[model samples]
Target: MQSYWNFPAAAGGTINSINNAGIETFKGNELDSLTREICQNSLDAIKDESKPVVVEFKSFKLQRNQFPQRAELLEAFNKCETTWKGKNPKSEQFIDQAKYILNEQEIPFLRISDFNTKGLEGAQTGELGSPWSSLVREAGSSNKGDSSGGSFGIGKSAPFANSKLRILFYSSQDLSDYQSHIGVANIMSFEKQPGQITLGTGYFTNNENSNAIPGLINLDPGFNREETGTDIFVSAFEPKDMNWVEAIRNSVIYNFFITIWQNKLVVKVDDEVISHENIGSFIAQLDDTNEDYRHVKNYFRLLTSEDSIQIPYPAKSYKKIGKFEEGEATLFIMKGEDLNRRVLMTRKAGMRLFEQNRISGSISFTGILIITGKHMNQVFKKMENPAHTLWEPSRFEEAPKEADTAFKDLRRFVRETVQQTFQAETTDTMDAFGLSDFLPDTTTVDGEGDDKKESLTLKIKSIAQKKKEKPKKKLKKKQRNEEFEDTLADAGIIPEGDQAGHSDEEREEGLGLGGGTGNTHGEQGPSDEGTGGAQEGKGEKEKNKPIDVEKRYVCLQKNEGLYRVNIKPEKKFEKGKLEFKVSGEQSDYILPILDVQSPDIQVISIDKNVVRFINLTGKKLKNIKVKVDYEQYCVMEVDLYEI
Candidate 1:
């Protein structure tokens, strides 16, 4: 029996895969999505947990004739052109370019093969629920079991997203003694013949049921797959589109390092291998350099360090949701400096689903929470979004309200554990009338503690009121208020004639100002409400950009007090000054530099907190080193501004 393409005739509008939302979402992010989706599917089909699941990404340009269903596929492409040529410009344009690629000397193909997997079962019987049927024939249908990595079925579209021709071939061998292979295309809606059209989706198979061809007749060259697994051939691959080697390596290391670190997954891209043996080397190279894997090093510590303790459960409490009991989950955390303050959330199988981030409060650290036990995994698996990158309560159809609460409780348990483990203290401030500083400095009435003190402003106001109560001149309301101000001044509540100098406490709470009282705490200048001498230096705010901590950074070498700084000044500024500020918990203070040192820089002079440099009109960025007074642990945050 010969195998050929059949996009059966249709009467009316067809379901074009070109407009497929599932495939469209993965287009721009093909490299990352391809690695994630393929690895996830292989892990979900793990045939032996005792051994690592092996995946190989072989990128090669195969002979044009070696391309499966070449003639038949071109025939379909021909029909694709005629069917939608004038009606749909998108389809017409795509087919025009696709036909050019089909005739190329060598066709690019990325063959992804996985070993030690269950592969696609039910190929012999063509069962609808089989992995083979669900993957090859159906769209938006899944056969993944409980706690599987994916069930939304959109992940299958990731490979096609990388295909410019929008075509792929599926080949798999199951332990059930069946080998099945077929070609599938996701194209725009098109006509097959006059008064006949087909759906945007079509498969290269023999029968009407769209069963995959029996299998491959023989293995090619050195690539062989005797073990049970699947092979996804991405046809019409473009090497220039991306560096597949780096993409595959980084995606696995960033997203599934936990799986590899646990010795459960092994990946080979071209000839490079990434496994637990060399995983650290890969991570060390990316540490602090890659924002995507910013916390992976700390997360690795939590997994491998002896100090990392697993929280024993029902330990504090968690409200059970469905079959997930409070004790079924496990969380381990480690405290360290410079951690990204995130926790890796994953199934017991070790594939990282997503991160539960910003869990770190005063304490800096990284953590990992493994959703263990069958029942607990099921609950979280249901909560995962379509991409499996996040857990959303609304996605859990079991019970939205309860699921939301349970997820919160789960996060709280982890957060509380990290806090308790690190023992970081949060200072309790005296909040007076919702304003912590509303009540001023005071001597206790009974000479008691902080809580029993009376407000000094209120005490002075009471004394002034009592003096005003005595019979005096019958004055106007405005005069009466002026007399009160003078009375308070005489009583030493404020300065003699000072009406505009607000003390620190009064300024903070917006209460009153200092007068005859000895405290002079007027730091604020005239407001910007009017134009005059105040607006002279305020022109600095109009510059194109200000060099902040994010864009300009300093690498402090404590021994030498030399700070390596790199910054780009606003292009519009012809002159600029560099400044340094030592950041503290409460506020930042100026850090005086002893000298500015750099071969490429010429400094004019140094002001109190400013280092004025020579003309920088045309320069973009410069690497310069500055020296500060030698102090063991003093660090500075560098900033720049246009003079």
Candidate 2:
């Protein structure tokens, strides 16, 4: 029975030492990597699409005497200890620990079994790209298709990394009715004889064909995988390390929650079943205080919340990325507080790759982008790093230009969506440690148009405080004309021949959304304020000339009525203030005079608007930022005061 174990002696110059660089890729993320890889592989081999794939993570103990090839393994360990006495201290220390573990009366092991899958196919043939070979014998080999969750084969190392003994057993009952078992040890080279060195990698098999045993061997008396699918066993699983269980549970919930939510996968950690039926319960029980845990909680919330906006990724992106076939995918965004401001990108299979971080805007939002078509999945899968965390441009060595534009297009699409949908720059102060991101008596109001939803930057106001606004004192025609002339003079806009196309009726009511400078025909800047300033002194001819303001951005924060405006000036100005106004189907009007705050721009006087802010800062008045406060409303518009 023990004759099948094989560890051949290497030639004189060749020596097999322990090289765990593959496993080391998952060093700090052992359990997560393991959980993610196992479920992904299982999902890839779904035999029945109607049934959910079930996986069990359980622990069992076996006596040392029942361990197969105990004597042969002990001899190898003893030889390794003697041969590498002082050469490799780490290896020497590891071998000492492994030897001690082997001598214990009962050893603990973890068996991960998956059911309702085709299992490892082509087990009868040890081909280079066979599932069994790719998983057990070969390194960095995969025959999975585009729809599959992963292609880079380094994921198999995760399970081995989890083993303190650096040993694992692979047993599978393939759908073809073939059952086989194999034991692989990743250890250091050992001196088999006085002058002979055996290879570091050893196999436990019986015959000349050392790939696999005929049938599954009994690992534990009560624990066995009688169903179809694969079972991976890790020796010296560190049963005393309860942290491992927690790590496994967290990983399952974080990475596979979508899979479970879709009824495509189910995970069991020592009888604690995490399935589609209980995903909400599991998420509700999680303490979102843990930043790491909060991500999945929020993601799950976005998945189920009807408030989430489903925006499809552009079909043009497929063509821009040099792909012929179009793929369908959606980015679901939930705009609110308690968000990480990142987008989670997942394969169509429902297993997430990673949260795409540093999304361009400061919107109080988090999202999930599900890549759901075969061709598109293939495109992104190729661009993914070995870890599948980000979409890197360097991956497209053939066409670097397309790679360059792909990211720009993605970001532009997201920006355009936000502008078209939210119609405002959104941001919020994340809860300062211990403080809740929630408020009592939250309120929401209807947006401007049929399509517009609640504004992300809109502040909450109670019904009691939301009484009708006090009407603005109607200004006389002369006063309105004079005010209009002053605003035009400051904006450097001398309207066409006196009043362009305005009548006494229009002039008497208010500015009446006057057309001039850059802000005519309703072009809101999406951020800072509506266009037209001292900068636009001339028409298209002045396009190349410098302006008083180069660029600016406006952000509406959580604080009631607070707005932060960032301004970059093209030229120096001793002072400038941003005036506020409102215009719509109704005649244009001014906001009720309120408080103003700024580091650079001070309240010289608040008639309608006055900042002529800060000496305009920066020696040359290069750029200045200001935060102002007033009654909050989405219709508010701004204008840079007298230059």
Candidate 3:
């Protein structure tokens, strides 16, 4: 066998380097191109339909290297080199030629022609041979014409900015030819000479060409039937440190799905279908209203080359109406040259102004702006001061008197409208929440008994008490069960029965009475009964009443009744006379019975059950009738006057 190691050195080494770099390197420029191609494809897909299209991002995974080494790599390289040499064109020369073709084509009208030497209008451009171009052709083509977003054909150079290896695959329909075709392009940067680059192209095959261009390749080789669509793959390349997904999302705004597709395209990245309807929906959601339709009335005119043409640009508007609660309107503009494009612009009229000194303009209107992709560098030229005065080309040009007056009127209208809607002069909190009328006019209370003036102290106190008392009942019940059961059960009983039989005769033997034994009546018993019974009965009667007899009481007769007294003779009277007083008053007073013959008061001895009254001697005295006031003894009284 021929030694595979002896194969062409240049080709094998190049292929090997690319294989080693892996998917990220291959993904490089190819990913960007794929994004652009898919966006373009979506636009083409929606050209003939009015229904909203749904584009989905499907699966994407990197595959390993599989290309052969040495001889096989040499053969592939030779084939590409031979084909490229056959064209006999430099890279810049090819770009110029492509531009010339686009400018000469008459398929669509060019909106602005400032690049033309005489600033002429309404010139025809020829048809662009292929909608897509490699970096070599883009750099070499002399004629800069409008077919897509790129002007100097530099848009194709964007993929090489941060990538080492790249691959791109796309499928499109040729409406004129009534067929579909699949195309693939791949590129790689050489390790030996980092500046050197290589590219390749090929097509797929299918039995039926009805759904594709006659000589075009079929995108899905396994599918027997032909379908009109495209797919792209970009691998092994590294993207810039910036967020690529956000960059792509922003690009979708300015370059609508239709224009990117070249009017006969349908593309997918990994597998996301890119369509105008889907892009429009995205823009609609972004603006949050139909107000964007008003801004869209203006046209984006891209002019290239000295002989470029300008045509009357028609404007289309779409509107959405709702309350003012929706967010402010935003407009996105993509402008500038490759590698230096500005991607975001907040001003309505100056969004896409570039800052790199290469391009200048304003993308201003009445909305928010996001400018991105390869064109940012050509639009805004300086980042130091990127305002309207610095970046907008219009600022440097003279304006007609009428135009100036019209612009002034428009500015006034915008200012007034913004004021009415946003109330910009007022504080943000006050305007946003409409709280101007909510503040209290006065802090002081107006009335003495206003309900709102009730104190919260009492309510708080009651709530605190209830919280403290709730746990006590549970504790008491638990203690009763554990410690107090027996005391409660035996509290109230009397003993009797067997004690009565033994007590009669034996109880008499212990008695101190002089009576003998049982039932017979005798003189000794009678004498004993009379004396002992009397003394015993007296003692028993004394025992029946309260004991600790400390005094003997006597009833003294007075004019109206009799009063009882307990006094010791030896206890000296403070005033040399007897005095009686009640609890409430300070004066001492004595009461006299009115009829001495029958006293109303009664007195009894310590153990006597009977009482006796004494007759009083009438004596004339100045204060004999002592007033015993009952007022001092009043405890509780009830009013019975109504009855």
Error of 1 at 606 (Å): 37
Each prediction's TM-score versus the true structure: 0.66, 0.67, 0.29
Note the Cα lDDT for every prediction shown. 0.68, 0.66, 0.26
Please count the clashing residue pairs in each candidate, in the order shown: 5, 10, 92
> Candidate 2, residue 265: CA error in Å?
0.5
Residue-level lDDT of model 1, residues 94-174, one tens digit each, is: 888888888998888888999999888887778887888788777798888776788888899999988878888888889
Which parts of model 2 have CA positions greater than 4 angstroms off? 1-3, 12-16, 239-241, 317-321, 324-327, 336-340, 357-363, 424-643
lDDT tens digits, residue span 1-643, model 2: 5544577766775675566778789887677888888888899888899999998888888799877778778888888888889898888888889899889998888899899988777667776788888887777888888888778788888888888888888888988779988888878788878788876778888765567877886786777677789888888887334777777887888888888999999999986999999999988887767765788888988889888999877676444565533436777887877566667778787877766543323355778888787766777677778876666766866655676566556555554565456545333333356443443223433433555344336676755656797764421222222233334334443332223343322322223322211221122221223322223333332112223332222323424544333333434555444555555655555544355555555545454333334453642222223333444333444555333
Spell out the clash pairs found in candidate 2: 4-205, 4-206, 528-554, 576-612, 576-613, 577-611, 577-612, 600-614, 601-613, 601-614
Indicate the worst ten consecutive residues by lDDT in candidate 2: 514-523
Q: Output the TM-score of candidate 3.
A: 0.29
Task: Arrange candidates by lDDT, descending.
Answer: 1, 2, 3
Runs off by more than 4 Å, candidate 1:
217-220, 239-241, 313-320, 424-643
Better of 1 and 3 by TM-score: 1
Model 1: how far residue 272 lies from native, Å: 1.0
